[model samples]
Target: MAQTGIADRAARNGHAADEGGAGLAGRLLGGLARQVQQRIPAADLDERDPDYIRESLPRQWLLASLWFRGEVRGLGNIPESGPVLLVGNHSGGNMTPDTIVFTLAFYTYFGVERPFYQLAHNLVVSFPQLSFLRKFGTVAASPENSAKALQAGAALLVYPGGDRRSLARGLGLDRLFRLKVLPISLALPWGINVGDFLGHIPLPAKITVEALPPIDLREEFGQQPDLDEVYDHVMRLMQDTLDALAAERRLPVLG
Candidate 1:
């Protein structure tokens, strides 16, 4: 209790000397976030170019088809209009083939004119080499950007992996954004790649994606349902789908 009081007082004091060495992390993360925000400004939403998407569809499709040999199903289940919350798993390190496949599928099915956005890591959006991703509606994964995309009636795709807090935030998103939670599953038979920068990647592998039926929070869960229950249900549903996908794989990347 004494230590707790000291810590509380330190926080209340808001002095670097009183931070108990907590200021380093805050400073580092803040600097990084600031640098990323500079590279990919909040106004980057306007960078979503329909013409660019239209022209790049063939290239993305070829990469998805010939390279990854990707296939997607149940995309029709998504509503034709309005905002949507696509929650799914992602793999393949920085060369995330699952996202590439899904991007092609979504653009072709919905048409380039439709507003669609994807939340990506700050590093991904901030990388100068990958700046073109912004043109494809890839925004830095932040609450403000997510809210803006939803407000713009854009379909938002999020891979809430390794972050239970993000997954739990679905409860608040449901209430505020009135967003429909669609549990999507993407399978990479190749498994995860650590994104080795020093060496070239091996031959392309197969990737399969499935968009499950949408979940209406109010209808599926009670009016004031428990967040934990919702999280468990979603997690279970995703895991089962992944297991089923894994079972079908006879080989690793060759599949």
Candidate 2:
């Protein structure tokens, strides 16, 4: 009789615990739904519009062909149909012209309908003037967002260094200096000295953007991956490519 009572008590406790866990999960899901609803419906760009991209192709073509004179290598490295992470070193300050060049080139080569997304800073997506970025499938950078994109069989472009880090490293400026002056220059109402502009006009820099071989995290790192090792590997690959490109350039803007 005592054993039966003890077992009954244990079962009751286990049932209570299950109920508590379900309640907590329900609350979390409810809160997540509310947060999603609160977000601006128009601003919630979870996908890309191929039609919009198609319409904008001409302008991108002009920029890639004439303005930046950008060249993309290693197109063959990208898998024909699968999730890919196009990691590259960003350049051209707050306004990453290299990103634009690469995006245009990628779409032109692959066509707009193919699932492709570029991860960018939250500020870029939130800015009023840059709303057009959403149309081009530029999503705010986040681990969750990236995972979702990959799961959906989309090719994702990510600059691991991000805006400040990439700009500082690419331009060879101290990270502290870039952080301090970048905001000041951006916030300046005068519009005379925008840090990103480089000068009154963008110096006609012959930017060469390269696409390194795609990395399948599952294949390379296995089920249990060491992220630090993966990060180091990717960085080394980009650094090597950048060194090669730098060597090819005869002059600063005239490369």
Candidate 3:
């Protein structure tokens, strides 16, 4: 009966299962079954699975507390309820330990039940082991996705550096002013700088992440809205905060 149910699910997902196999071939077929499961769009991910997140929280907490030693500030600026956009710089290349640290901290502080989502690149979403990301409320970065998440009254986290070309075009005025922009930073004391372009292993780094006050487009920019002005204001605020944090760091990775 259980085997029948598995076969039915595979058929519904447009994947055919091989019933006949043994040893290496059976193992290969089992691997394919798992891949098919990952590819199936079981849910639209409009809201996160709080139970799944709760189940996974302990491991994430351990990493955040012991491995990264992450500290988050200005969380009070985040409203207890309502939609808000969190914009931050991207650091530490492909591995992006900073994102992991911030995310775990955010969920811990707010509890897993809160409707929160993080925008990520499609590559990251499609990558292996990251399939669980969707369950934890990560969506591929897109204008439509962003609008949908906000409309649902969920807090959204976005990294401008994650999409450099779009960010550059949108914030061209900042470049013209030669503004110092810092989106995200990771301090590694072990001297293992695992940048995206460099490698994958993350060293034990004391990560500190801060969340700025929420910005309401309708309230701050009015109904009409000034895109250029809004862009400049956000970048400047982030840059100022980055400068302050940098000042406090006496050495690399020690902060």
Candidate 4:
């Protein structure tokens, strides 16, 4: 198009209008100047990362904590070293931020160096802008990939409810949901320790990450591998854990 021609010229020239002194910033500016001289920025190319970007967690942790404005409890419950499956309820809209916050908290409080690989939706890998999100060490939640991550001894964070639970029709509803059993199935076979992290969250409110006891998968894996049966079994176990935590919260403690 005619517009594309103009933009290309500008990018080639480096917008002299904005250039002052020739330096590192000037060189960078020059590249932009060329594009602006003729065409717009969009006419140029774009780059996106498909894996987790190395970011400043110290900064992100502060920002995310403030964003959620919630308290994180039972941080000590996370194992110092070992593979873990963090199963929690997902809220509609953006569960990524929530997971990021939880991931940062674990690193900040527990000093976890092992990369935390999360299960991403298939759509994320299909879209462009969303695909950028995939860069953050997230693998699609497919049977093969999930198994590989566990086998490789990587810590996994998943919201078993998936989109249906996280993207429920209502907002600011209940935070609890049944957990998925596949993760347990995968963990037990690999002898990976599983942790049931209870995120007792009230939307537009403070967040509490109650790290519960690790769920042993040895027994569950022995059963048939039918996904339906696995899902049901995991759901019951997760619900029981959540209920127990709720009861504990209700109890009065004497020091």
Q: Which candidate gets the maximum TM-score versus the true structure?
A: 1
Q: How do the residues 1-255 of candidate 1 rate in per-residue lDDT, one tens digit apiece?
A: 644544444455463432435664554455454555556446367889999999989977986788677887778877778877777877646666677788788899889999988888777777788888889889887666777777777888877655676676632455443444332322223234446433656346667777777777667776676777778888887788878777777876657
Q: Which prediction has more favorable TM-score, 1 or 4?
A: 1
lDDT of each: 0.69, 0.60, 0.64, 0.46
Q: What is the TM-score of each candidate against the true structure?
A: 0.78, 0.67, 0.69, 0.50
Cα lDDT for residue 89, model 2?
A: 57
Weakest 10 consecutive residues, lDDT, candidate 1? 181-190
- Model 2: per-residue Cα lDDT over 119-188, one tens digit each: 8877677888888888888887665566566667677776656543443232222222212111110000
| Candidate 3 residue lDDT tens string, 179-252 | 22222222111112364534456767667777776666556755554666666666677778777766776667
lDDT winner, 1 or 4: 1
Clashes of 1: 0
Name the candidate, 2 or 3, with the larger TM-score value: 3
Q: Give me the runs in candidate 3 sitting further than 4 Å from their true place.
A: 1-43, 162-165, 168-193, 196-199
Model 2, residue 245: distance off in Å is 0.6
Q: Superposing all C-alpha atoms, what RMSD in Å does each candidate have to the true structure? A: 5.4, 14.1, 13.1, 17.7
Query: Residue 100 in candidate 2 has what lDDT?
Result: 73
Task: Tell me the TM-score of model 2.
Answer: 0.67
Of the two candidates 1 and 3, the one with more favorable lDDT, higher being better, is 1
lDDT of 4 at 56: 59
lDDT minimum window of 10 residues, candidate 3? 182-191
In Å, residue 171's CA in model 4 sits off its true spot by 26
